[model samples]
Target: MLKVFLVEDEYIIRESIKKTINWAAEGFSLVGEAGDGERAYPMILKSEPDIVITDIRMPFMDGLELARLIRVKLPQSRVIILSGHDEFDYAREAIQIGVTEYLLKPISGATLLTAIHGVAQKIRADQSRIDYRAIYEKEHAEKLQLERTDFFKNLVDGKLSMSQVLEQGQHFGMDLSAVWYQVMLFQVRGRDLAEAVRPEAAEADRQALEIEDTIMDLVAVQGHAEMYEQIGDTLCFLLMAQTREELQQTETSLIAKMKKAAEGSDKLLYFIGIGQAVSRLHEIKMAYQSASRAFSARFFSDCSGIFRDTDAGFLPESDQTELDLSRLNMDKLDRRIVYNFLAGGTVTDVPDFVRNYLTGLGRDNLNSLLLRQYVILDSIFAMAAFLKKQGISAAQLEQFQNQFRNFNANLTLDQAETRLCQCFDNALALRDSQSQQQYGRLIEQAKGYIDTHYACEDISLSTVAASVHFSPNHFSSIFGQQTGLSFIEYLTQVRMAKARELLYCTKLKSAEIAFQVGYRDPHYFCYVFKKTHNLTPMEFRSQRGAKAAVTGGTDACG
Candidate 1:
């Protein structure tokens, strides 16, 4: 119901108007009444009514002044002028004050009722448009975020040339031009969801997501870095600065924020790998590769902290020519280190893991042919055993051994490390390929569910994940990895696709189409339609019709 406030000097007129209409029955609520504008202003401000009906020529705080104040403070409220005099000046001033209705006094209550009804309908329509725009803006923002994610992935992946990167950066509103640039990979290492119990794993995933969100928020607040969410529970940030020193400072500040974000959560461990600062866009690939190598340090160290390009390698303290075997740390040669690394490492970890493993065996000891051969056989058998535990057949293990049959003590430490990296890389590749098959099936199931239920308004990440019997966070990780889009982005894609088909092939109005394809607000639906296709529904339909007419095919539905 619309709230109505009244101000008239004559009590008799006010009572008569109030008595004439039963406010409740007329769909109006007569909230307050005053004898004059001075008395009415405060009451009107308090009630914040939708309609203000006032007598124009009052003693102080006249109708014009009240209307002006309302126009400034409560612009949404409509005003009606009641005047005893039929003067041109009063009507003109009322119009100037933006009054909804300028009624000469001695008016009946029926005239006032008609004016109020019109204002109410206008307010409802205005509110609907406001709501529509809000929804449209939200969806547009989400779509832009996903597009930015893809752009960042391509930017660091070296799939785009320098010119292409700059052009695409411009399109996405990212200023890629910088004097110095660096890439940082922020990773969340928590409980292994596959090995962890269900409830505990889900809780940890939730906490990890919250921590990541906090770090992302911090990065956004800094304004110099651009952060993108990646698959595998990682955040990729591109930090830009005017000079190398400034870039170093930016990296330091961001790492502090990240560490603070991880402070309270024991279950949520994090590592940040910052690459070297470079001066060109194309060099971002080199920076990212170095950052990734640094990131893989966590596999060997199993510690939560920041790593840098210098931390990526495992070099001996001195040249092997001056190395002392007497000072060798036999503890580093423990076979469990290699076994543990193999059990929980990725292909990216192979190089650093191999270097660290070989260095631990004593660089000087690697010169003794017997010890060197023992080390090689130990690593080879470790890989064989790891692959076997993963269910590689005896025949497959033999095939794996065939690749290394030429291995001997003739290899230098560098050569031995290189060969070991290759072996670990192959084993991890096989393991990942098997894991990918399972992930592929889960993703397909989730996508199928989303396709089937895209028209349901309640469809969401949680709902789709539940359908596939996975936790929401875990599903989110794999969904992005497999599809390159978040759950919300994928759902919007499905809804928009359906909306497009309806707009092109059917005679339904946009609102009806919105309802049929999961949007509750028709105006919002139209807004997203325009944003996605650069044309409103009607415009798209007309464009399609024009094309069909040119081609001598059936015209699209009007």
Candidate 2:
């Protein structure tokens, strides 16, 4: 109900007006009545009445003053002036003070009711606008958040062609078309130590953000940069440089900045991988793939610190070198050698081993795989040299180099069988060490938390971190690095997964399931669910002959 305040000096007039006006019927309440404007100021300020009915020529602080104060303090309030005189000057001054209407004294109920209704309508209209603006802001914020997740997911999935993804990104409010982009991948270690030492997950997240911001700031001083996503605990950045030279300079500067950021931070070590430049959107995914592969080189610790696929030296040589094995048509022979060695058998003569083993295989059997391994082994030694230059233990590199040499020197027919088997065992062990199950345990913990709490409306990175005793910032970085899924995407996936469960298990209404799964609005839940799952809740349930069940199955209505 709208509240109205009265300020008139005459006692009889004030009481009569108050009693005669059917305020309840007109959707207003006469919250206060004062003998004069001076007496009414405090009451009006306290009640904050939506409409004030006051006499113009009262004792001190008349209607004009009251209206002016209300305009300043409570601008949404409407004032209606009641005056004994209908003088042009009084009416003109009342309008100047933003009085909505001037009612002559001895006011009739019908006329007063009309004025109150008009002000009430204006209030309702104003309220609608406020409500709309609030909804718009909320939806806009959510859209931006989702777009960030979608962009990164698409890049990783290789589902949409890069050009199509970039085009769609524009619709989602990202402008990448005219930007010069280079991708950087970060490989993070020391997750266990970081969590053990820093109890606050939010603080860890803040530190990560600070690191990213610092890197971006340093890059910005030279050129523009935009962080694409934090994949797993690693941060991926797409930098825009003015020229090839600038890109190289920026990469060098970023590497230095990141090393500094990681230094002295307990349990944090950084390995950065940079990709070749790509001018067109269609080629961006290729660049990202290159960077991703470079980042993975941390597992080998024997490749270039920065691997650019565009570098001719990094590419496989087309011409067959003496060591190429391309012309040897040795696929069957190589596999046999590797298998025998892995099975604990051996070859005796080096050159004789190759020629005799491959004698029966067709020339067409030759492929790039054998040649590539040869190139990679060569690069591994080169990487060991680079690491030594950077102050790494020479013994470590020398150990690996010796192994490579042993495998090369034993190229005789008999030893080839043994060396290939040894190489197979070593490669398998390396791959096993980098498996998702081995390195992704912490990420699984975070994901488990998400699966459990995604139904809470307030579920977020902060809440998840709190549950695990991590700062939100640290959790975000670590979780991303471990799972390659950002916090929001992971959460959304959890929600959608639960929605699927509900759709299959019971007969709860779609709206109820939406609320049960932490989405307050059923319409929005349906929209997001369909976007993720390609079917509305009901449609999905229908197709599977499954029904959404309530928590207890006591009330489908819920």
Candidate 3:
């Protein structure tokens, strides 16, 4: 309720006001009343009323002076002045003194009530804005949650530079210049294929998060761990320990506690790949990578156990006689099978394609289980990154995860293979539902827009993406994927292609050609043209009659 104070020099007028208005019904409390400004000042100050009504002409201090004093002492209070003065100077001075309402002396109760109601509405609005700010701040704080797995993933994946990482880490007061840290990667298997098709995948992602919460909650009590989520069905955690023994003890505690937590849960099963401890903060990424690689161990699918990369027996003796394959043994899979699957192949044998890929990977390490898991997770990340840039989002990735069943203590090899295949089928179904045409059309439209507008100096990725009704980021990804070129590359290609035609066919100077091709800075344009075509405008024009060397490939397409 608003607290209101009344100060009037006229005794009859003050009593009439006090008696006529029902302050309670108006949502105001009549805390105090005064006859003169000087006498009322201290009382109103003591009462701390939200609103004050006073006469401009008084015995001691006038209303303006009282208001000026109140403005300093209680700035939030609203002041109303009732004065008979018709002088322009009077109203001006009241307004300057911050009076909210001013009325002539012969004022009606209804007129005063109107002013009060207006002030009340304004006060409510101001209060509501204040409350909204408070609520916004709270929600913003919630966005800074400790479990920002995506941020950590980016950090480990080398997406952020050291300075960027440090600057972001500073917002949360994290000092990354630590002596020792370990990365924990957990690969979880969810319930059968039928159960994981939920809206949020709250059930599948839960397996990793559950172990994460259990370990982090306990370790947080001791201030020893920080964790973040990464791509795929994995969560990465960094633990800080001063001593090797403490690190070992912490890992042992985490393993034991997490195992106990998942004892009866039939919906989920998980195992952690613990990376070797590293001394430098920058080396933490290496630790994470090692942990990520460790998740591929084929021999260790025991019930929610912890395995460290530093363990002597963790990796079998290397045979190293075969070809040094690519990231996560992609070389193991037959190119045709992998390409067929990736090219939106038939769903009937999609699992076989995946299983064939898994079976093909070996590097003297006999741990087929670990190798298979590694390849699968790595393939998801790789394929997602690859497909996302083209616009066919890895929308099926999560759905694939739902159907994917990796090895677990409770599952046999045949059961694992069956589930893995089921996962692929599920993935194919989701992929089919979202055909390439969704973002494909957008990319085509974007390219056409760029082609039409390339000569405009202001043409940019954001503008082109906007023309196609997609975000710059999404447009960039899809544009890159569809054309096998980035937005900038494609845009530059179009400009250069036009510039080449202009250079070869017309007599325009380098600068004019540059301008016509959307290259505002001629020297910069020369640099880019040289970079793209290995020839300056003059050189390219000179070579127009020579064997059209750079004109046959994507160089000509651009």
Candidate 4:
């Protein structure tokens, strides 16, 4: 509920105004009352009331003075001014003080109530904003915490042998013999959809978790299995099966269930990759890596389908011949050939047939990046044709042609193809190096600044950029390239990492932690935490605490 305060010199007027309206019905409480603006100022600051009602003229200090102070100190609070005179001068001064309503002293209950309702509505709206922010912050913190723990677990488990539980326990921070295991991969597709759904990414992530839970529940009816969704968008299920065939069958059933749940979503479709059965807990990361790679393979084929690499005809034999594009000595000529082939195929079958011939040469050895470039060029050409169909001038198409030619001239296909396997890596490094030089310092300095300032509550790209003497736009671009994360993403990651430390090491309330992490709204922090880590802050803390205790006990016993 919104809290309200009143300041009036006249006792009878103040009392009447306080008692006249049903504050509760209007969604507020009479937090305090003062006879003068001077007396009200301190209380206003202390109570942090959402609405302040004061007479225009009061002893010691007038309503205008109180309003001004409140505007400066607690800008969120709404102010209403009451006066005996509805003079132009009085109203003008009230307006200067940021008063929402200027009312005459002899106001009716209805008039007063309307003003109260207005203030109440403002308060409710502000509260909603605060609530949402808090939820997001708390969730964000939790997600980070969960991800950290899960990372450690996976790393330790990956290194351990089946019978080497004791050694793994030291690394995983837990006693794992009794704990069940399941691995889940949450795959997020659709670049356009990911961009569109960025704001609601947290909710989408929660939905993914719900999907995992559903899968587990369905599979639990058959046998004992532990399920875990990893940080990267994948789900892993680990459990004992009577035989390899039984595990495969269960995996098929699980995939079918997941597909049904993911189908028909507005923004995203699900593709699951189930790994080969491994009884050893230590080999979980290998399984996870396999599933992750399998999931990525879906992009090479069709969308919205489950794929198991171990299944028949999923992936071709490792001994498949390599596509020898190396024989093409003419750099520009080869690219032109590939581009024309893809473009022609997009238009008819000639391009597709060429691609098939290339595919047949090396099903396993084909360059996916080169293929993507070909696809993009093809789409660009197709779009040019589409524009022509829409009556755009040939001149416009010529401009595009010129631009493409310029871009192609600048690109060295021979060098690109030579480094094709390391293209992403080289591109990332080049991007980062240029960004660091542009920022005029090591990227680590910027990261350190963010780490120190993340809890400022008003921290943003503009604010940080200004501090570093760079424009927000420039800083944002450089930061993304240098850190491989957008401005907000980097800040959130730093805050989340801090939040994880706090969750594991401290007993601070989630709300307090939210503020500590620079989020004024705890709820929003939680939402972010959960979105990143797939667990609530409290849940994460509890889980970590339990693991720590288990590890500590084991150590003491040893």
Which candidate leads the pack in TM-score?
1
Q: Candidates sorted by lDDT, descending order? A: 1, 3, 2, 4
> Order of candidates by TM-score, top first?
1, 2, 3, 4
Q: Each model's C-alpha lDDT?
A: 0.78, 0.62, 0.65, 0.60
lDDT of 1: 0.78
Q: Summarize candidate 2's per-residue lDDT along 1-558 as a digit string, tens digits.
A: 889998888888888888877889878888998977778988888999988988888887788888898899889889989888979998898888888889887778777878888878887767756654654565455446546655765754467776777677677655565445678876444333213224654465556555655655565453445554453455667765667777777777777776776555553445687887877666667777667555543432322144444432222323332344444553443332332221211121122223323332322222234543453354344334433433345565566567766445425433443454454344334333333453366577777887777888667666777676554544665666676776777777888878887876677999999988977667777878888988988888876653333333432324
Candidate 1 vs candidate 3: the lDDT winner is: 1
Candidate 2 deviant stretches above 4 angstroms: 1-125, 155-166, 186-223, 230-234, 241-273, 297-558
What TM-score would candidate 2 get against the native? 0.46
Displacement of residue 344 (Cα, Å) in model 2 is 34
> In candidate 4, what are the lDDT values of residues 77-123, reduced to their tens digit?
89988889969988898887789899886898789988788777766
Error of 2 at 492 (Å): 14
- All candidates: TM-score: 0.71, 0.46, 0.39, 0.35
Q: Which residue runs of candidate 3 sit more than 4 Å off their true CA positions?
A: 1-132, 135-151, 158-167, 187-189, 193-222, 249-264, 297-302, 310-558
Candidate 1 at 7: error in angstroms?
4.6
Model 2's lDDT to the true fold? 0.62
- The digit string of per-residue lDDT tens for model 1 on 468-527 reads 665454576678779988777788899998888887889899889999999877777787
RMSD of each: 6.6, 13.5, 18.0, 20.3
**Residue-by-residue lDDT tens digits, candidate 3, 158-267:** 67777877777777656565657788766455542223345544545545455555655665564566655442334566777878888777777766665676556666
Q: Which stretches of candidate 4 lie over 4 Å from their true place?
A: 1-148, 151-153, 161-184, 191-232, 239-246, 311-418, 428-558
Between prediction 3 and prediction 4, which has the larger TM-score?
Answer: 3
